[model samples]
Target: MRLFIEVPVWLGDTIMASVAVENVMTHFKGAEVVVFGSKVATEVYKAHPSVSSVEVDESKQSKNRWQWLYQKTKTLGEFDLAVSFRRQWSTRFLLWCVNARQKARYRRLDKASIHQVKRYNDFAAHVLGVALPLGDLVLPFAPHSFARPTLGLNPGATYGSAKRWYPEEFAKVAIALSSTHDIVIFGGPSEQDIALEIETLLHEAHVTNVQNLAGKTTIAQLCAYIGGLAWFITNDSGPLHVSAAYKVNTVAIFGPTMNTETHGWHNPNERIVKLDLPCQPCMKRVCPLGHHACMRGVKAKDVLDKIALLA
Candidate 1:
């Protein structure tokens, strides 16, 4: 069967959707599946057990992007199934153009209420009949490549700054834990400053083994590095999810906007720490009141202890 899968755009979304890829492979047993998405994500999963081929959207540069799908549809040959993680109503139109024998998707009321991971999984389970029990959505990255151990320090949250635990606290944790584990901080381009600030904190503490790779490595690189870590301490962010996805032991600190169904994480060796603040988990990236109890109240020591357990 020529199956066409759409990937979720965000990093965590992409990682979570890996489970869908594994589902497709297991459901079909020996059937072949093809994936469509940002070239980056496609490449990340290209070697994965499920994906047979990657068809990058060549027409993305053109102004009429949908036309590209239609064009690609005609050229790529017919597909047996088209499943999408994309929530835009336009996805229906895109899947339709794929000329698949059948079309499937998550049970969403409409374009407005679509959650990325649910949309992807529902389509896989309901449409493709891949209702394999929910497997961890993590990617299989090789942790053995890196010779050194790391204290996976994530300083950015995809939601926004409000979800971030204080950087100074992260530095303090690094200072305390550096003697035990190398503090190898990680994040994205937007989080260079956060990583650097933590590095500065480490410097102030006269600590070593702080390698800030934010904005330096690709998603694949980040995932690989995450595998080499002894433990991870992070806020609600893509890297945190990625770390959990790799099944690396993690302590996902929550400030706001949390629930395991969506953000709490699914890895076995993991725990979440949040203050019992009434106004906590406001779910808003930026708290209305200046006092950010959901995050600010959680102490560095608690998280460090969690990391120790994982280590």
Candidate 2:
């Protein structure tokens, strides 16, 4: 059988969506699973053993998205089943193009799902009449290693500064964690400036193991090294989700995003650090409140305490 799965835009969401892929394979062992994804997503799961092949959608999926996708999926050949995690009207258009005998998609957007690792599997149950027991969307695959920081700090939040815990707070966490572990820092090319700022502070504190890997390492290599960590402390970013999927003991700091439903799929051990600010979880990419109390209120000691509990 040939199967098709339309992917989510973010890395964390893709990790969780792997659960649905697992479900499809569980019921149809011999089936060939083909994934249609945003370009970056194809790279994120490049090594996935179960995927027969991945077709990258070069066109950006956005409003008026169906006009492009309708012409795109026409090339996917005939598929036996098409299952989608997307709820947009655009999803219907892609389903229309796939030459599949059966098409399954969520009837409504379900927000209560914590990890989206399992809830994403609902498409099958709704469309195929298969009531597979519910499960979390955490991937079991190990990331490829680059350099494991005997001590690691990811001080940048890819989404925006609002999601970042104070860099000084990260430095303090590093000063403390450095007492027991070697430290290396990770961030994106855009965030090298922040990584430098934090590294300089730690350097002044005479803290060693603080090396800047921001923009230096690739995502795959970073994820590989993170999987081997004794513990990972991060803001609400893709790495946090990757580490969670890797099942590393984690303490996640949050500001604009809520910690309840989006932190870690099914890992009960994961902790999200935030204060009870009334305006929290506003869901904006940037903070509307100039002060950002929800994130600023989180202290390094509070976060370290959570890591201590894990140890």
Show where candidate 1 strays beyond 4 Å.
57-61, 108-123, 263-266, 308-311
- Cα lDDT tens digits for candidate 1, 1-311: 77778776567777767766677767776666878877656766766776788877555587988887788778767787777777766667777788878776545533544444555566677665445566676575676455555678887976688889889988888888777678788877888988899898888788867788888997678878887677788887777767777677788888776544455346787888877788865778688888887888888898877766666
Candidate 2: where are CA atoms >4 Å away? 61-71, 106-115, 136-149
TM-score of each: 0.87, 0.87
Q: Give the TM-score of candidate 1.
A: 0.87
Worst 10 residues of 1 by lDDT: 106-115
Report the lDDT of model 1 for residue 171. Answer: 86
Overlapping backbone residue pairs in candidate 1 total 0
The sequence of per-residue lDDT tens digits that candidate 2 reaches over residues 276-303 is: 7779778877788688888878898999
Task: Compute the lDDT of residue 182 as modeled in candidate 1.
Answer: 80
